[model samples]
Target: MPAIVEETVQPCPECGSEIRGDGRFTLWCAACDWNVDPSEPQPDAGRLERAGRVLARRHGEQLLGEMLDGSGGRPRRDVSAVAATVLALAVHAVTVVLAVGGLWCVVALGGGIGVVAGVVLLALAWLLAPRPGRLPEGRPVLLRADAPELFALVDEVAGAVGTRSVDAIVVDGSINAAVTSYGIRGRRLLVLGMPLWEILTPEERIALLGHELAHYANGDIRNGLVVGSAVRSLTVWHHIVQPLPHATGLEMIVNALYVLPRLLIGGWLILLIRLTSRAGMRAEYLADRLAARTASTPAAAGLMDRLLITEALGVWLRTEANRAALRGPRSTRRATDRAGELWERLTAYAASIPEHEYERQRRAGARRGHQVDTTHPPTHLRRACLLAGQSEPAAVALQAHRSDLIAVELAAARTEVARRLLRGVLDD
Candidate 1:
């Protein structure tokens, strides 16, 4: 695999040109004097230190609290971890109180139509009260528990990482993998993107699944989910209270009283969610480390290499391929069989790009800075962390039988995924 790896070149740190490598593992940037030793990758100690500091500031006491005796210290996963939930709950509690208070005030003000009108307004808010965001779903083929052939690989990976067993496995037409939890105590759903699966080797597959499943074991994604739900609930509350309530000429002025309170509380909730961005970046680092542990450093790094290539080149490749395939003879599930071939072509194309273009893309990705977003650290940072001082890819479950099982057992599911993909193309 490493023989073909020159196709996956690292971006030069100084100039972002494709790093030129000698026949034997020593990579140098022709455009810049950036030298990279793949065999002896350097750890960015600063990144690890920063991650530790964030964990200390936010979760140190909680990590230690679980070891102590009865109820003195904040319990593990105490108020801090779930503080967002507490704040949202507080908002909801206030909502209930205001609704009840309005009801009482209306009854005191009059015994006629005013009471009936107040009851309706309060009832409307009650009906629309915030719930956790519904888990994102699609009409993909679901792998049920009874499917042992499919569960075999999934269970092995989940068990390796010590994460909870997946409640469901879904195969989608997209090219990504994710594990998501919807609400408090929500079941975890695993989504395997078929196109992604088509391109990854079983080992690389482990790296991808391990990384996502690590999100589950680490409570990283759950925290994000809570933050999302809290934000959504706040938005829901704001919209409910901001609009003018239904009332006549003089009564309209009275109903306008709800606006200021909504604005103040909604304003703070927005600020708090933004502050949680730091925590999100920390979780990403931690999850990457966990993925390394499960999939081995080399496998994780390889997956990242392919991912970078895909990110840099996959969109155009997919659009072009889809357009061509629909116009070609082999346009059904048969098209997926050519995914590895497509990926190879794309990788070659990516490798052939001029140094300046590579640098421009790297600069574009780092336009704001090295941070990818609130949820992810920069790819460059993650690439360094994965490659730095790491062992060769872990060799496990690489038997031909396993690979064959993955392909044969999931054939029907993959067919469904391809069907959905083409259906969208046809609809368009």
Candidate 2:
């Protein structure tokens, strides 16, 4: 007899049936309470730092590396993936320090001309300093900490993963999860999206949670904040120092002096940013390994697959027909009540797609996995990492039993978020 090759696939988040196998033409899982549709039809959870995670990490590690390294080859000789950020930061620091020394010498010896040179360099350094910057304010919707069920889940996931508990959890509308710290105090925060929650089975949710929390455990979040800043500073250096465009007098001349040099030196900033991005990609692979260890390999890989497909399926179905309706005659308050309606419509929309199309979509997602300067590596790489570490599929519990409770508790919040999303989209 010929050997049977069974391709490993993810299990149902509900009754734990196989989602894929060596077989063909299976879209729905019958043993589950509800079908594994485009996303969960009812309340799964609501929260996240959507944009922060969706966008590539800009320049986080570089910021940390610059201020900390004096003679930096690596941020520290012993640390892995620290070289790119450290070298970038060290170069930045040396430039500044040398400039400062030159300024001092000019002030003491060169007299007036020296002082002029020092002032110019000082202003330049201030604009170019690669300190971490604040995340944009409104990309995420912050919920008060009193949401006990939500907090309990976070705690449970953290305990299971043997990682530190996050201090705050926020929800956004995007399909992503992330963790980060901000400000001098470095308060830990976890971000997960409502849409992301709606898509996963309970264990898959835990897998997602474990993956995000893994960033904290591996110190990726803290390191990013410590060394990295938003990458905007590099590209916008000229704008930061440029004089108002309408100005025609001495102000324009000053702007020319400042902006011209920044334009000339912009190539250096671009190089550092690219290097920082590569470093972030390596860190992502590490986080994925941690997630797979904390979550079962299948669950982790499932989450990756789903995430890849979301851009095409979950997002496409929801937004394709409903933009006008959300912006239509219904009041903001009524939108909250319409949650179930929208979910059903979305499920139906996804269900309407042919199975062949769905498989094609999945394949398409795999192809679009990698991009230059992005924070996450390709989805294919992430799945490989998870599978490589696992000898066999680890059994994760099928039902979390928290989905209904979370949905009930989070109804009002979900409605509010929907309303906010609609308002932003339509300006109504």
Candidate 3:
């Protein structure tokens, strides 16, 4: 049985038709779609972040144009990409120089001021070192023994995508899913955001898995250890060298001392972003194509549809939590009861989205340059690329019973995430 939708009627701001929704989600006119999404677009903050977004969007548009022109597969190495790789190598060389200099100082000049300077240099070298990614603490780690069915499904998808199976699966409360490497051994971990997972069809879930796993096969330089650590090092250096605001006396002198180095680091960071933006965007397209090849075109395209609505789903979750928090004081219902209903309500809200709303969101995403993140191309372009790319039969599929078994495995994670989400709102 479906959860009952509690409707309230009000006049729309755009047109005088009645707007209806359950109190927990956005209410809009069915006739005019007034206030379908009331959230204002947030602009990227900081000069560097803004510059990166500009580069990403510009490159994304160019890639979209190439796809439209029927140019397919990985993009060729252009001048910018070649130059960016060179710069990345140069950044790594700096790290190596720092490490060698630190070691030489420690070994050759083994006393007093020399030792102190060597230690300082060594610390900086360690800070700039290429660290492997880590699995976040305080998240649920699902093991094969605990989630064999889920792991089996991921293994099949990995095979289909020509990538190794993830060593672990982590379930969290975010609105996104991702694959990342952890520890010195480079063990892969696939993080499944339950909020996003709950709303997707089983096929779309496979598509999501296929898409994430394909990143391993896509040769995305941005994710490689050398370039990734270089970017991190530059970011850290920029922060360290950035002048403090409203400095006085000694602080003012220190701020002035950093001006030149700050400018140099900032310029290099921006240049790296500009040069690599096209390659990064192309890697995303390649991942999407492999996802389609593994999960069938429709499933991959449907996953894009889910991506477009992520903002709406987030808004709805926040809205629902706020409503529940407010209602807790007035209503006779226990907070536990309200918390337990959150997952069900989320699924209901997702299912309740109409076809017109999807269209409206799609058009809005295109207009707003909506993307999964700065590293990926715009959502609309990714979707279009899926439709235009060669179609493949699904190499992996989720049977209904197997999906149910996986859901059973995820039961504890689901309850924990829901309680955490509700508690977050209530604590606020």
Candidate 4:
């Protein structure tokens, strides 16, 4: 007699439909159009399997190389790290020399206490520097893979590219996705957030995921972490000096003698950060290009456009929330009540503004450019770049909608600036 395999049936989460299971890892949902191996256990099992397959096929060679190279696949020498380190050492050496010279006693006895204060400030800054999060244990997981449609699409793309099965996928609540490395060998991981999945079309999602995979394929994650770690280590000496007490007048004078060398070295450290940020931006563009090449050009362009729009909208919402938070209870209550009443008014006001007017403003800003405010380039510039690469026919359509996207981004940017300014005022 042949052995019998038991079958299982479950209702689809998205729609009310019966789904038959083969007793393997399976996530079958008809309502939201999800179907994949029932045997795969995960929050969104099907999606994970699909993404895993895609990454394995597309980035297998690069991942393998990362594992073999170790040190997170970082180059042996980083000029920025070296320069920062040399500067930090020079600063320390000068401090030591000043301490040994008679200048230290003279300053302690006299009135140059500012040198001591500067050292203290530097120490505190070092101690307060942001620490990088620990790398995930295994490969990063792609979450929410149970949606059958998404899984199938991811699988199709992955199979086309020839990836091995992925380790796992995890979901975050935010509208973001990232590829991370973990463990001694630096296995790859894919993380997706729910908000992003909820908003983007399947093609856009794949493009976003592809962008992350490009990071792995290009060895950006490992190299980035390594470079960051080296930079942190080199700068940590500043923290070492923090516990020292305020210098006397004599000590202050000695410190002044060392200030010139310290300043020269510090300048190099700042240069390193600027250089690294510029390099990182270039890496982002490279990844964007790779994503465009791997996926269809139109899909990549759509993804970029959607991302900018979402970012802009999100920023606006956050800013409004912050403003509301800042108001007194009575004001807040009134604002809440008036929110509904103001909605239509605000909408109408927004509609009255000509679309081209906004685009003109954004373009002008891009041309004039502001000081680098964040690691990433302004959305307007990024969108312009993406639009430039689009084919003529597609570009026409994209340009037509550019105003809408810009409006959303501009609102968000303004909100963010307002919130930051408010926070600064409150802090003061």
**Predicted structure with the largest lDDT when compared to the true one:** 3
Query: Which 10 consecutive positions of candidate 4 have the poorest summed lDDT?
Result: 391-400
Give the TM-scores of the predictions, in the order they appear: 0.64, 0.62, 0.86, 0.43
TM-score preference between candidates 1 and 2, better one: 1
For 3-35, candidate 1 gives per-residue lDDT tens digits of 243344577788888664433233556565454
What's the residue-level lDDT of 234 in candidate 4?
40
Q: Mind giving the per-residue lDDT tens digits that candidate 2 earns over 178-219? A: 777654666668766666666676767878887777666655
For candidate 3, give the lDDT of residue 406: 93
Give the per-residue lDDT digits (tens) of candidate 4, residues 14-62.
5768866544223354345454222222232333234333433333334
lDDT of each: 0.57, 0.54, 0.79, 0.45
The lDDT of model 4 is 0.45
Measured by TM-score, the strongest candidate is 3
Q: Deviation in angstroms for 269 in model 2?
A: 3.0
Q: What 10-residue stretch in candidate 3 is worst by lDDT? A: 419-428
Ranking the candidates on lDDT from highest down gives 3, 1, 2, 4
lDDT of 3 by residue, 81-134 (tens): 678788888988887888888888889998987788888888888887767888
* Poorest stretch of ten by lDDT in candidate 2: 40-49
